[model samples]
Target: MAHHPITHGRAGLNRRTILATGLLGTMAGFTHRPAAASETPPFRYEVTRSDTEWKARLTPAEYRILREGGTELPASSPLWQEDRDGTYCCRGCDLLIYSAAWKVSVPKGWAFFRHSERDAVLTGIDGPVPSYGMSPDDDTTMIEAHCRRCGSHLGHVLLVEGSVLHCINGTSLRFTPA
Candidate 1:
């Protein structure tokens, strides 16, 4: 038995197991998880891979956040504040999209770039109307951006404050020094 604050008249929760499951639950990949797939809107990418291949190619967290359509916790990625001279590319495939010079530090808690190479990434709806998760008030509708070449979920793009916020997941990007 362990002390946990989250309670709803549940009994006999193994501490480690519960904690691990709770943590994993917060993470979803770019693709739908089995639990959420039924509610997920139809989407397709030219590039397809078997679940086994994607699992093997990505880390557990990456697969969850990229393929399972899970989200990393806010402020969890160091790249949110990363300002350096380099190129930011897709983690799933080494395709350069944004330059370091245009990246901005926004309070959104993800990598915010002013723009990207138009041809390097594909922009599309992440879901149906009210396309964002939960409520439009909490998670507003935004366009999802993925690797045009690999079809890997990068993050999202939206117009905010007269600038296009290329809010990318840290797990979805790899930085290369110029």
Candidate 2:
């Protein structure tokens, strides 16, 4: 007896069906995959030899975040709602981060679209991970902010959808009136 193949209107595992099923499985696998353990934590400031001297120069909020592990109140930062022609400098070191002309308002609290070329505020990944764990549904760009002078925690660099990362709410941040 010969084995007859089932003829059901283009049956016997079509290429399109196989590819579709494989793609679906891959998407499902990725969708339910576990997230990584690396997560960005809240902004915490560290001290240096000159930190003591800088602390004397900063305000209470600046000291709390740049020197000690602290977070500034949301919408409480004057820079968040600032609409002036000035620069945003490090509260701990007075290094310019944002230019008086580059500041702009965005949704993620106080948002700045540009940074000064000589500004010291920048992102570093070698720092410790934050307390929160990575979320599978969230983006995976870890940003670390440090003082330009003492390398203290001014706050965090939030990665926006575009190539823009807003550095906001760090305790070591201060705005200078131009």
The top-ranked prediction according to TM-score is 1
Top lDDT: which candidate number? 1
Q: Whole-model Cα lDDT per candidate?
A: 0.76, 0.59
Worst 10 residues of 1 by lDDT: 1-10
Over 1-178, each residue of candidate 1 has an lDDT whose tens digit, in order, gives: 1333443133235435657677545553425534322334555655678889988989999988777666788889888888888998877767787889888888878888888876888887766657235666535456888888678888888877788788889988888877
Deviation from native of the Cα of residue 153 in model 2, angstroms: 1.9
Query: Candidate 2, after superposition: displacement of residue 107 in Å?
Result: 3.1
Regions of model 2 farther than 4 Å from truth: 1-60, 126-141, 161-163
